[model samples]
Structures are given as C-alpha cells and as structure tokens.
Target: MTRPLPYFEVSQRLSIKEKVGQLFMPAAFINDSEEEVLRLEKLISEHHIGSICFFHSRASAATNFEGKKEVIHNKNSFGRLKELIKRYRAAAKYPLLIAIDAEWGLAMRIENTPQYPYAITLGAMQNQAELVFEVGKQIGLDCRKAGIHWNLSPVVDINLNPENPVIGYRSFGDDKKQVIEYARAYIEGMYSMDVLNSIKHFPGHGDTAVDSHLGLPTIEKSEPELLQNELYPFTELMKKNIDSVMVGHLAVPALSHGKAESASVSKAIITDFLREKLGWSGLIISDALNMHAVSKKFDRKGTVECAAFEAGNDVLCFADHVEEGIRNILEKGKTAQIEKSFERLWKLKERALSSELVDGHLQQDEELMQNLAKESLSLLKGTFSELEEFRNNGFEYLQIGKQNGLFSELLSNRTNNGPNTLLGIFPKQVKPKDNFGLTDTELQLIGQTLKEKNTVLYLFGNPFVLNLIDWQQAKTVVVAYQDFRSFQENAANHFMGKIEAKGKLPVTLKS
Candidate 1:
C-alpha cells in the first residue's frame, strides 16, 4: 500500500489554471435532479473550482410552505451532500474542499441538526472558552460528518456598537481580550478535529451601524485605534496559526490611501497591513463577492476579478460569474499574479487535506449536547422565585421567534405543558425597506396578551428585534441569544429552575 502524498507537494505541482480555479468558490444549489448534479460535476471537473459554500435554504428538503408536502428533513440534505461530494471527488483533479457558513452548527444552515446558542451567548457564558470549544467541536463534528472541510465562522469581530445591523449576535463580545480568549479556544477546537475555521470581517465589522451586505460600511477609527480594538482578535488568532481570515467590504478611510475604497479591495489593508504588518500568511478570502459592497462598485465581472486579485485576496468567494472571473484574470495576462494566488490557495487546501477530518460518531454525544445547552442559557435580569411565581400565577407566556426549528419547538415544549399559557410569535422584516411594521391588530393582541400573562419569554432570533417590542409589562423576561433549539431549551430550563443561568447579557436590551 502506498502512503498518501503530503498536501504541500500536491499543491506545489498544481498548474496555474488549476490554482486560479481554486480561488473561485461559488454558491451552488443541489437538488434531487440529475441535471443539477451533472452541472456541479462539470464545475469541478472542467473549472477546477476549489470550494462550495452551502446555504440552508438552498439545501433544505422541499417543504410545503402553502399546501404541498415539501422536503422538510435532513435525509435529503445528507443524501444530496453525499452525492455532491461523490461527484465532486470523482470529477476533480484533486479533492475539492467543501465549506459552509455553519456558525452555530449544521442547523444554522441546514434543517434537523441541533441548534446551539449564537456566538454572543457563548461569549456571555462565564466559561466562554469552554463554551466556544464545545461549539467548535460540535460544529466540526457535524461538518466532517457531512463531508464539509471548512466552516466560515467564529466571527472574531468585537461588537463595539450596539447599533451594528450585522455582527451583533454573531460576534463574541465587545472586549478585545474576551474575544481573543473565546475565539482562540473555538479555532483550536475546530482545528483539533480537522475542520478548517475562518475568522471574519477584518479589520472589524463590529463598529459599523450599516450592514455591509446591503452597502459599504465605513470604519472611522484610526489605524492605532483599529489595531487596539478591531484587529485584536485577528492578531491573536493569527498568532495561533488560524486557518483563514475573511476580508469584509468595510470602507476604512484611515486604512486606505484614499477615502472611498472598501477593505476587501484595499491593497493597503489586505497586503500592507494584514499581510505585512500583522504577519499573517494564512489564506485571505473575500466576503461574498455578490454583496452590494463589492458588486455595486464594480459591475463588470472581469474588472471585479482583477481588482480582488490585485488587492491580494486568495479566494473570490460567491462570485456572480466565477468562470468569467477566472477567464478575465487569465486573459488579461496576469498569469503570474494568478500563480501567486493559487500558491496560497492550494497551500491552504493541502493543509485542509492533511488535517484530521472531524469524527462523525461524536454527533451522538447526547449528554455533551445537553450540558452545552445547559451552560449556554442566559439569565439576563430575573430570579427563579419570579419565574416560579409567574408560572404559579397563571401568567401567559409568549415566545417570539423567527422560524420553525428546534429552538421554537423547545420553547413550546417547556412552556406549553406548564400552567402558563404559551403563545409563539413570528415576525418578518424585509431588509433595505426598513419597514418593520406590525399590524394594529397584532400589536393590540400582543399588548393584551402580555397584560394577561404572568411572564413573557422573548427568545430573540436576533437582538435587534428587541427594539420592536415593549417588554415593560412582563413579570420575567429572558433573552436567549439566538433562536437555536438548544438556546431555547436551555433558556426554558433556566427559567424553570432546572438549571442555573450563568450567561450575562453580551448585548444591551431596552426595557
């Protein structure tokens, strides 16, 4: 039997074309259709694409939203994923690295998997390092079981601004040292199990009020200020040899030569500051290229592709036209630059292949999962006596959540069987419109119900939603960091005196 060649040796031998191809990781949708599978196969075989980022909605089993019985389970998700990997490996010149934005777990991006607390909740825990390590271990285990090699998570950005539309619950915390400690543990856990982790939104996305997904965000801090706060986690993580850093499209005038360019395409920020000043040699991947922050400025595919490469990014993730982007760089006779990018890209892939993939059997660690759930719940500002009183006094309990998942179900299970009457509320807010309106009737009903209820448990999907409600009337209020089922179950257990709430509020909530 022959021993497998090392990743570095394999990467060094890859052609320029293959190396360039490795830089383009586009979003792919896989269904049960044969044509979709074939198209995916062609992308791997002919284009030499390096990775695929899976979205939960894209891979979700068809579900009957209106009337039809659409796919609503993990069987399809797992089966399709297996088939995709099988096809990807069979057609590729080398093993294609598979990645997903499984920040919390597969449940965050896929259905049926256990939903852990959001990063902010973990950050709030008294045992942040342990919490993050558990999170990383569970996520890594799930990703490896599903044949995923990369996890775009452990959002290391410090939540400096409460008004930040993004990076709120996703962030570890506002304190630099706390963020570093928690993030380091999380990265180590992921790497320990062979799941490559990517720290995101460099130099930081935590201070901006605007969401970069909608448009460019400006980080007005001075270089020294950024180094102290925003860049702290990245610097610390890099010291530990983190697998990757995702560059967000943040417009930092202080970091850029001129005042207007985004950081994703800023040579000074990426190459000079991040690469040289920070001494990070790991992969530098751009945030989704299709986001308005990058796409809106550069309309042409070729121009965007050239600019990203020139700016020193190794991977052009989520490009609109991945093939065109690769061709433009090659056709423009920038093969040398492409080769450099490929060297970094292939080196990272080689590292991934050489690393120990996550063990699937750990997914069955029910006791460990339960303990994690218990530890991650937050008790914000209330006592067991208050909760017990509320439960005994016939107070109606209402659970406000975003979607139907484990979190909602756990809340339902906990509050439903109790003497408290539980009502689950789901709110929808479309982005860019800024129209977060509730009908007069709905508002009246909520107010009336709260007045009648003994306690109100608001399991916020995101902390931003807290502003939309009036929590003054409730006897007891709990903020479960996210809508993950584990969070909900944990929060419920805390409220019922089954577990102690050791988590602090990572973000402020309006009373």
Candidate 2:
C-alpha cells in the first residue's frame, strides 16, 4: 500500500478548492449525453466534485419515469459502466470515490451482473450466516471489478412496517436481533473483501409509509422508542470500525426537537446525537440531496447544500448544483467543520483505494444465491410428493402479475405454452390506484385455472399480496417473498421437489 500524508499534515497542505471538493459526492448515471458528459467533466475539473454515487437509468427495477425518458436504455450496461467509470476517474482531480447502491449486488442497478437474494431472503435462512458473509464478499469483489470504491448498503433498518414504501424486502426483517447479526456478518464479509460498506438511513427509514424520494415522511417515535427498536442495529454496528453512516431523510421530530426537515441535515441529530452521544468518528454522509424530502422544503437549491454542510455531514450526496453548493459551503463560513470533513474523507479514500482491484475474477455466485433462495422458499400449502409428481408429469404454467417482465421472465424455464392451459399467479400492488406496479388480476386468472386443471399457485411478492384473497381454495400454494427472476427460478425448483422447501415465513402471513 502507498503511504500518504498524515491527516493533520494533509489538512494543512490542502487548498480551499481541494477541501471543498472533498465534501461533495453527487450522483452519476450509467450512460450519458455529450452535454451531460461535459457537465460532469466541468464539475470534476473546475468545481472539484469529490465522489459520484451511481444509479441506473436503464436497469431500473421500478418503471417510475415515462414519456421520452422511458424509452432510453443504455446498451451493454456492465461493459458501458466499466468504460464510463474509467473516463470519470481520469476527469477527477483527486481519486474520486465511485459508489453504488448495490444492495443485492450490482444487479440492483446494472442489468447483467451477479445477483444475490434480497436481505429478507437471506435473513430467512437458518444457520446460514456464512452464506450471507459470502454474499457481501462477492458484492465487494464486484465493486472492485467495476472500479467502485464504496457499496452504499447493508441496510440495517429493522422492518417495523410491512407498508413501508421503499424498505420492505430491502431490509432484513422486523426482528431486531436477526437484523443485527446478519448486518454484522455482511459488514465483516465486505470488509474482508476490502470494499467499504455504509449502514444506511440512520435512526431508521424502515417504519415509514411514505417514500423519501417522493416526499418527507415523519417517524413519530420518541427518542427512547428509537433507541430500543430502530436505533439498535446502528448502535451495535457503530461499536465496530464502521466506514460510514448515511443519515435518513426523515422528519425525526423527537430527535431534532421538532425540526421540519429530515435528520440528514439536522445539526442536533448529526453532531450532538450521532457524533457526540454515540461517539462516531467515521464519515457522515447525507442521503441523496435531490430527494424530495430535503429538496421540497428548501426554496433555493444552494440552501439545502449549505445546511447539509453546516449540519456536520462530511459528504453531501446527490447534490443537484455542485458549483452553487460549493459556493454556499464557502459562504456559510464553517472553516473548521470543512477541514474536519476533508480529513475524514481522505482517510476513507485511502482505505478504499489501497485495496487491489480484481479484474474479472468475481462472477455472480448463482449457486449460492439459489441455495439461499431454496432455503428461503416456504411451502405454504403443498406436499413434496405432489411437487415431484407435477415436475415429472409436467404441469402447464399460467402467469399472473406484471405481463412483459415479472411473470414472463420467471416461468421461462417452465412449459407455459403446454396444452391444458395452466394457471400462472402474479401480485397486484396492495393499493390498486398506486402509480407504476404489477396488476393483481393474474391471481384471479390463476384461480380460474385452478377451478379446472390440476394447478400449483406460486406467489412471488409481498405476503400482503394475499392480504384479503382466499388462496386456501387452491390446493398447492407457495409464497416466495419477492418476484425477481432468481426467486421465480428457485420457486420452480422447489415446486419440482428438486429443491426441498427449508424456508419458514420471515413475516407472518395472516391469510
């Protein structure tokens, strides 16, 4: 490893622009236009932006955007990213820390990469802590291969609300003990692989009904309540040498003395509660600055950036205006805080960069992912003999839920095109009127098919998808937590008795 200047010495050596550069880590996309490319280059070369948090414009799981932007898809996403990142590194004045929300691996953002099961699926595994560790290690290897320095994940938030808009399957589960153990194992795995991990949405975003990306949600819990439940994982994780903590964009009124804005840019919450009370010396990064939670409240864009800087956040993520934010930081005149943030950032940059980048060495651990998924697949109402018989006899498949994507992709291996039209089951978003989600009518079609032919109903979504529906009428029913291609494939294997169902329900299914 290359030895660099000590923190204090380096702090003394740096100019104003370099120090300012250390405090911003704005967002980056996979593919870009010529104009946007020039904009990024200017941000790096002139304003000296420090890092870039990468998100997918093409490989997005959610179809949230529409119109002309909807048709834009970046080709060969993984290869494109490698070339794009190389150019980004060359543009930076400092070694810009490349970060991504690889929660379940790069497949979460990038189209073609190794994908592990979600945290909830991993949490459901019995005595599979080592498997979870490998998941992290493999993700770290992926990051190094992709020229990424940081993995903005290992979401430690305890899932207190099944209705939580964003954090449902992403979190481990509702059990705090399970969440803590799994999070530690994951962190250790990533750390062992020499990639940095950040425990996210500090003080928790797991219990909210609203999505911060849309608007600010209030977590109306008392401080004591937060400490016992929501804050447990964060407190436990902090005892270890944690790399960074991403504060949530929540209106944690109790923690901030009734502040209207999210905790990400609250002085009392970040400085006094987290830094002083908890004694966290690692880097403190705000959640995405462009998020509506923070952006909607501030009239001018620069104000949010300035407040986040003053709130003691070491790095402001997803800031829309890098130049204006930097000017605001300078105008705010928090010289001491800026230097302190710069030194901490340098420490993280060195630790992350020192790890050797392994090229094409790590492939997605599909077998491991399958094993865990099989372990997590539950037999809600079925017999092993029946599954084996159906596999041998060959049952026709009928698909429900999302047509072109979720359902079509899942049963690709199964003979959905067979005679004696088989029933395929899909889920509807719990609420019907919600924008952009799969329809629930597929379940009804499966029900209709069950009335005639011998059918096996497989549910691949939130357990609440069966909230009010009577699924007991169908003889063989399997409820796999979420509907990704891997989950669907594993569900098929379980249905065929090739893989026995070892998974118990991670959450209680009232239906």
Candidate 1 per-residue lDDT, tens place, 1-511, comes to 1122465676568777777788888775544367766776787788888787776443341121224435434446666665676677677776677888888777666655656666776777665577578778877878887778888888999887767776777887777788888888888888777888899989899888877776788988788898888987888778775778999988998888756788898889899988988888878998877777777888776677667877888888776676777787777636776766777766666667775544343244556556655665665545778777765555344443345555444444444355555444544531212423445566567677667755455544454555555656665556654544555567656655677776666665544
> Worst lDDT window (10 residues) for model 1?
57-66
Question: Stretches of candidate 1 above 4 Å error?
Answer: 1-14, 56-75, 331-336, 355-364, 388-394, 398-444, 447-460, 482-493
Query: In candidate 2, how many Å is residue 108 off?
Result: 1.8
TM-scores vs. true structure, each candidate:
0.84, 0.88
lDDT of each: 0.70, 0.77
What would the per-residue lDDT of candidate 2 be over residues 1-511, giving only the tens digit for each residue?
2334566777777688678877888777786666777778788877777788887863231323322445356558888788878888788766778899998899878777777777877877767778889888888889888888899989999887756777877888888888988898998888988888899989799888888777788988899999999999999999995899999898888989887768988998999899999899999999888877788778886888888888889999888878888888888747888888888898988788876777884476768766677777777776988666665665566666655354445445766444333344555542322421444454455556766667677767665555445667666777776666667777766665667778765655453
Q: In model 2, what are the clashing residue pairs, if there are any?
A: 398-423, 398-424, 399-424, 400-426, 401-426
- Candidate 1 has an lDDT of 0.70
